[model samples]
Target: MSDSGPVLPWLVIRQDDNGNRYRVGRYATEDEAQKIADSLHARGRHEQLYVVERISQPAL
Candidate 1:
């Protein structure tokens, strides 16, 4: 974050009943993420959706 390359990406996901996090997708804005979650919910996937800031750097 201190290096100032680009702001970290936001992750939109939900934890399943089995304690597994469903990696929905990354978005530039929370609203975009929520739209995806809402669409999924309309189809009957009931789980809490949230946005998480993640490091943009690739994992080594």
Candidate 2:
């Protein structure tokens, strides 16, 4: 037998580091994640940020 689950929405944030790419954070929604990114930008951590829509794999 096999187990499967539904897919859910996720917000992925990515940042650039001198041409190198890295993930900053992941959240349940874009709004929530953007808010965090805005805060980070205010603190001067990241100069460029983006929000991406994604779906995680099945839980089991």
Candidate 3:
């Protein structure tokens, strides 16, 4: 079997404010990331979930 693992998109869950009492899951794609954000927003937890910001990919 080939020793290969599927590339997993990195994610970072953090708060947006300095209080640092929220969570945000970053994703490789905006759609995927936004989905989480939207869910939080729908549940009236936008501030708690913060925003899904994507990190710049390093040069391969």
Candidate 4:
């Protein structure tokens, strides 16, 4: 058998201040996920933004 496909990590985002959490999106590369996290962090402004960030892992 061949190797499994690339790992697509789940990228979830949440707003800390208002207790609002949700699944923003998923990425096949950590760099992609980080971009979004960075964007969200910048958009958070004064409020705290939370992220359930996970590493690039293969699907089980």
Instruction: Let me know the TM-score candidate 1 reaches against the reference structure.
Output: 0.55
Tens-digit lDDT track of model 1 for 18-47: 778778777767666677767776675555
Q: What are the lDDT scores of the predictions, listed in order? A: 0.64, 0.61, 0.55, 0.69
Q: Model 3: which ten-residue window has the lowest total lDDT?
A: 1-10
The best-first sequence of candidates by TM-score reads: 4, 1, 2, 3
Clash tally for model 4: 0
Winner on lDDT (1 vs 2): 1
* RMSD (CA, Å), each prediction: 5.4, 5.3, 4.4, 4.2
Ranking by lDDT: 4, 1, 2, 3
Once fitted onto the true fold, the runs of candidate 3 whose alpha carbons sit more than 4 angstroms away are: 1-18, 21-23, 46-49
Model 4 lDDT tens row, 12-48: 5766677777777777666778788888777777676
* TM-score, cand. 4: 0.56
lDDT of 2 by residue, 1-60 (tens): 234343236655556666555567667666777787677667765556554656565565
Residue runs of model 1 more than 4 Å from their true location after superposition: 1-8, 46-60
Tens-place lDDT digits, model 3, residues 1-60: 124543325454546445674445546566776777667667764455446644555466
Instruction: Give the per-residue Cα lDDT of candidate 2 at 60.
Output: 50
